[model samples]
Target: MSYYSISAILTSAQKVPCTFDLPIPNRGFLDDNPGGDIAAHTPLPLPLYLAELLAVQQLDNRPLLTLDLPSSLQPRVLNALKADAKSVDLRGQEVYFFEGAARVLELLEEEEVGDGLCEAFKKRAAEIADHARNARGGTSSGEGGEFLRGLDEWERGLFRAAHDSSKAVRMWMGEVKGAK
Candidate 1:
């Protein structure tokens, strides 16, 4: 992702669960307390960027914080995606679901989660392409409407690209026939 990409910024801003490995003074505001110390092992929701930085910082050869999978990539969500990737509302889970997951996976190294996400993206991409190609008059209704509404930002871009390309191809074919 580019440094100036809006999607990268949004993905970095998404919060992830992190547990402090050591007590820290005057950082309790992270856990909703002010002017107090944060105890060791206190779980807090921190931005992905901050959490990743803290988790990578070493204190006595150990990481300062342990990063946990964000709620969006938790087992329940993964199971739902595994069951039916197209039915899961990825937008509801996170606007930048795949990007955020990629970042978290970099820190946590959860191979299963990576596999699940890849599978989900593959399944959904096929569905998105089908919908994009078959959509009538640039409008979606019924099941297609609901599915389109559930697409994350990246998937929406894919759908738009697919839809536009399908239209362009059709126009080109019409032009070719006319010339014949």
Candidate 2:
């Protein structure tokens, strides 16, 4: 097994559809392009949920708000976070969403650690959704939809982080690997 570790700071989180941003390093940015700089995103926050989505899609390398772990762990870490997305709920959701997001912070620690936990959470959420659908004969209205929409926005933030981070990660990983 490879000995790798990752660590990240939330950087930013705001209420009413909470959003968080993670900062990327310049070195990572420069890896992809000759003149690339992480500073370009300065003063602008990159969403964490969006970051995970991009990682899940493999549209980018790793998220900008990543740990200093081995390059190989990016996908694994991202998968873990995506798996956690399933835990979202519409009823009294934001409160739970915050908790759920916080819980995944450990997964953000690295690509490999606590990966399956996310899968389990997501699986359970899906089952609950299925059960609700069966009971209601369809989806509910009002609060639930609103909450789900909020969740989507949160996910978009993650996607944003992941996409931005991916660029930096990919660039850096490529250079480091090439040099090796």
TM-score of each: 0.94, 0.23
What's every prediction's RMSD, in angstroms? 1.4, 20.2
* Cα RMSD of predicted structure 1: 1.4
Which sections of candidate 2 miss by over 4 Å?
1-120, 135-137, 142-147, 150-180
User: How many clashes (backbone N, Cα, C below 3 Å) per candidate?
Assistant: 0, 15
> Which has the greatest lDDT?
1
Q: Where is model 1 poorest over a 10-residue stretch in terms of lDDT?
A: 135-144
Across residues 91-138, which tens digit of lDDT does each residue of candidate 2 receive? 233323333344344435543344443464455445434433333422
Candidate 1's TM-score reads 0.94
Question: For model 2, what is the error of residue 58's alpha carbon versus the real structure, in angstroms, after optimal superposition?
Answer: 21
Clashes of 1: 0
Question: What global local distance difference test value does model 2 have?
Answer: 0.39
Query: CA shift at 178, candidate 1, in angstroms?
Result: 1.7
